[model samples]
Target: MSAALLPPSLSSIFSSSSSASNPYPLHCVSPPFNLAASRPARSFLLGATASYSDPSDLSLVSPTSDLTVQALDQKLLTLLRQRKTEDAWIAYTNSPHLPSPTCLSRLVSQLSFQNTRSALTRAQSIVTRLRHERQLHRLDANCLGLLAAAATKAGHTSYATSIVKSMLRSGYLPHVKAWSAVVSGLASSGDDGPVEALRLFKAVTRRVRKFNDLQIVSNSRPDTVAFNAALNACANLGDSEKFLQVFDEMPQYGVEPDALTYNVMIKLCCKTDRKDLLVFVLERILELGIPLCMTTLHSLVSAYVGFGDLKTAEKLVQAMREQRTDLCKILRESGSEDLVENDESVFKKLLPNLTKQSDNEPPLLPKVYAPNSRLYTTLMKGYMQAGRVSDTVKMLEAMRRQDDRSSHPDHVSYTTVVSALVKAGAMDRARQILAEMTRIGVPPNLMTYNILFKGYCMQLQIDQARELLKEMVDDAGIQPDVVSYNILIDGCILVDDSAGALAFFNEMRAKGIAPTKISYTTLMKAFALSGQPKLAHRVFDEMLNDPRVKADRIAWNMLVEGYCRLGLVEEAKKIIEKMKENGLYPDVATYGSLANGIALARRPGEALLLWNEVKERCRVDKEGGKSDSSIAPPLKPDEGLLDTLADICVRAAFFKKALEIVACMEEHGIPPNKTKFTRIYVEMHSRMFTSKHASQARQDRRIERKRAAEAFKFWLGLPNSYYGSEWRLEPIDGYDSDSL
Candidate 1:
């Protein structure tokens, strides 16, 4: 891919080659090409990965006048295949010819297979440029399909979704393979991806059917791969109906379900506690003569073990061992005659006792012929589910004792145990496991430190979190990133250590570790809640000056609210206009602050108008209209804002408006409680009695008492006649109505 394939956000990678300030450890795998070992130097390789802004020297190609565009393209591809990545990239970039979309697609395909950070970055740039610029209209089905495939392989789900959605919105439906890649990426993410994937699948299918265009429908139809992705999505999200619907639709799509497909279905059935469906899927697997891989057998074992059916699980395990021995014997007998007699399968039951193979025993089978780690890990998982922590640890230890490195316990195994301990609130035990990991020659990395940091924060042990942060650097020798700092700051704020949070914030900046949006937001909120609004503004202004840190909607809202809390309504209003100019509309927090500020500034009418505008925007957003000024989803009327409105109404002597405000609160399910309403009523009369005409009222005692009585009756929402004689109103614990 040429430089034209670079995304705008990625263009920076080409300009700067320095990696000095990077907190993460650099681990580069040298390629066959004579490329520089520096991080940026290895970023993009021609025909594999390429970024273009400054044109390469075209003189080299112009000297060879006979080099046609086709010949140059072929030469570049050959160089790439020969692992001369840099040479190929230089030649391609220096060539004067505009490469075809097919050539760009081929380059993207190469980049996808490489699981390096550089390769992933290059793939994103290429996919973005392809979809947004440079003949997007001319993108054929094959090109679209390959783009999604590349994104999936690179784990760029957001980029993949953007490409597909952009195409769909422009009436160019994606091919089945493209749709499958997207669904698979989202399903595997384990976040809100499951919900989004299911929604996208339904919307696309419905839209395709509604259009009823034969070509478009056929090209964009969901296949077994797509269905499998959707099924996995449902399984992750516990959407049982959606799972079964996808399972039942396989044959309708004329696609045969494979063993992996059945594995996922059985897993889902096990997860959803549908023993009947589990049996049904297992029976179908057998009926179809689908050779069960270890995954299928493991799922079966795990389900049985999970439900306390260990008697049946033991039988199933014995049967699986027998089957494996038979298959191995068959392979030894049927293949190479050069095999030694000792090559025959030797079966043994190594249970409960964890030990390495004896010196007299035959050498273990190669990794390709050995059982995968998951087969045992599955049993460990079952023991975990049964709450047998000791048993699970023993199983994990047994795996570690094995001779083959491939069969040893890995990071996932250790992390799983640590995660389980953390969830059970056994932080000490989890920390012990982390130490054990290092003792076993598996040194703890950034992820290990992060898990510990999060555990400390969740427990509200800010001091402990701070100590861990130091240990991560001083002992573990791992550089803490922005996430590490953010966690510590958040933990401090949770413990009301505002000064400590600010110290950490300053430390982060001094270390040249740029604060992210989360970092700024954390500090902003901490100071705001700590009643240091001026300091919050200082933080916001600092964020604004830093080019690397972009202030998001949350940051802006915090700035506005902080100003309002300081009774700086005009300052808050000025910030709102700046927010709009930056294409960020004021959200609920901003409006809430504005309303409160208006009331505090003695402008009740304007406050009412601002509150109404907020409601109107909320209504527009809720109905799914394109609200021009809507930056976020609508929120309920803020509690502080509601109280302020009530105060404003009482002070202005607009009792009718005050009642309406209370009614609105009831409709919104956040009605002002009795205690708050009574306080407001009392405050209203206190203000009325302390008026400028108090001296004159004292001279005319009878008139003063009459007016006070009438006001008290009005406040109680009673008829005027109720104040006549039966219910005589008097100042409580006071000398006189005017003097008190």
Candidate 2:
């Protein structure tokens, strides 16, 4: 453990990148914080194979009934943690008796991180059954964390809060980690009212103080951590003074600033890019003689990057390298072995954070070819984060010199670059990376090949993906993992090969990669998109047997959309109830997608009802906060997508319904733009004349044209948006003006 002592409060800064796989590790700022500060040589050895940490990590600290089981559990936890939840779940399902609840809990907790919605549900059901059966020897806090996390991830934020609340009532009150979790949950969810979260945190502290007053006033205060969390809450509030106070509390409360603390502060300072305070905090941290961590460096780099201040970030990036080297050097010399002793925080599984890769600035490595074979893998990961693949080759070439060949660049380097290339839709680059991996005698891991297969499958190159599957069997002889099979199933869906994909899914199940939600979602969307909503519902039923797939919102949303398209509003309503029963909450996208579905069904009145529901949702949910995305580009109530739905409605012989939808769209704020107005009058009339609807809707088109004339006049009078000349388009030769 650290001689400096554990602080009473340790704030966690969740620095999530955009990539699902590349989560920026929580930059925690707790005194005497070091990468290996408390992790033993055992954790490192296990990290190599296990690839992640399990909730039962603390369980492994004590003797288990089965030592072999314990070792495998450790390794499994590592894998789950490393954005490998599906792989872990597959292993758990295939294994006998399974790693204990705590072990499963860690994987469950990581569901959010892994985006394993299905796995989270299965694990939760297991936990529920275990509790009902009175199978617990002791309550595992880690499991509770996972439960709460899953609740939130499933979009039941209120239920997640309830889980945390119940945990406290069940005598787990001293753990502030849960409070921090709620903070993180709120932050990522873009939820409103963090002030309530802070109050709850305060209540927890008060309870702790009452229980142990002397400890509360100790030298190691957790103020730094808690204050940082408060500061994070401030970011949402945009409360500058409160934000500053949170920053000032780091030292005032005697809690030393660690990487996460700095990261939180850095983001807060950069929120407005107010340079005066930014310089002060930067100088203050340097003066404290505490080493600045990578998160803070990234934040600073990003902060300056925002103002087009690459020159400043570039200079600091160099300084950051110096700091990283110094810290690494200190760890290297600090007996390199003392890192094995520290910690008093309770173990807990966590909620997932959706992170994208964040390494796309200037190159961090030098052009010079001094290949530190040892850091080659690290450099590869860095390059991948920066979204570069060619650099991976450069590093590999450097490794070739001086016989520095260390077999392959290990999974980290390979997966990093490969994952990035795949996400950027650069299949060619991904293939090149895979080829280079094999060319250099570094046989690609099954995971690496999966990445390539997934990329190809996404681009609808099922033939190529299948060919690689054959290679895995013949040349590699490696069995496919669940993800490997999932990709193939998804590819089949894209090609409307439900029969084939179902066969593959069955094969996967036979091979023991038990189907997850994804297996069914593909089939559902495939059938639904193919105009077979009935088949979609049936697949959803079969998927529910897995427990995890039951009531999944993603599945529900697909079903709702499909049913809506078929004008099966009742079925769509049923799908929504299933979603809510599963504790999933719908977001704007979910609502927006469903609303469009209603319009397609010629249910303009129903669509308007759903639209009003959205307005209400937006009102109370000021929490989802405006996204950093371009401010929605001025959608008119009567414009954009309604036109498409109107077209569909008209095709379905719902002429009056199509006009109603158009009217609703106008009522919504997308009043018909010029093109839409023109289309409603001229385009619809043309299409009606061309199609068989002319007899019934021709008079309606005449009425629409009269309204369009007034709308055109209004649009022409508008300032910059007016385009009278553009609207003239030769007056649609021979168009009957008398219709108006």
TM-score of every candidate relative to the true structure: 0.56, 0.51
Where does candidate 2 stray beyond 4 Å?
1-167, 172-203, 215-254, 267-282, 293-429, 438-447, 467-487, 500-523, 538-555, 573-640, 645-740
**lDDT by residue for model 2 (412-529), tens:** 5666678878877898878787787778666788888888888888898999998989987888778897778888888887887766665676566545354556767876777677
Give Cα distance to truth, residue 137, candidate 2, Å.
Answer: 9.6
User: lDDT of model 2 at residue 75?
Assistant: 73
The positional error of residue 375 in candidate 2, measured at the CA in angstroms, is 10
Could you tell me which 10 consecutive residues in candidate 2 have the lowest summed lDDT? 345-354
lDDT for position 100 in model 1: 52
The local lDDT score (0 to 100) that residue 449 gets in candidate 2 is 83
Best by lDDT: 1
| Residue 363 CA displacement from its true place in model 1, Å | 42
- Tens digits of per-residue lDDT, candidate 1, 1-740, equal 12343234222322332232222111122221111223232232122223453232233234444557678778777777686655654564566754455555556555555545555445444443432233344344455556666666655465466556655665667788887788888888744678878877776676676764567588678877888788889888766667767767667557677777777766675566654344445545654666666676667667667666655555555544444433322322322242223322111110111122122222211223344466666666666666777877787788878776776887767776776676566899989999998888878777767778878888998778778778878988999877888988888888877777777776775574657778888988878777677668777876665433457888988888777776778888888999888987776677878777776678777766775666666566557765554444455665666667766766665554555566556666775755655566566654444455567657455454445435444545544544545433344445454321
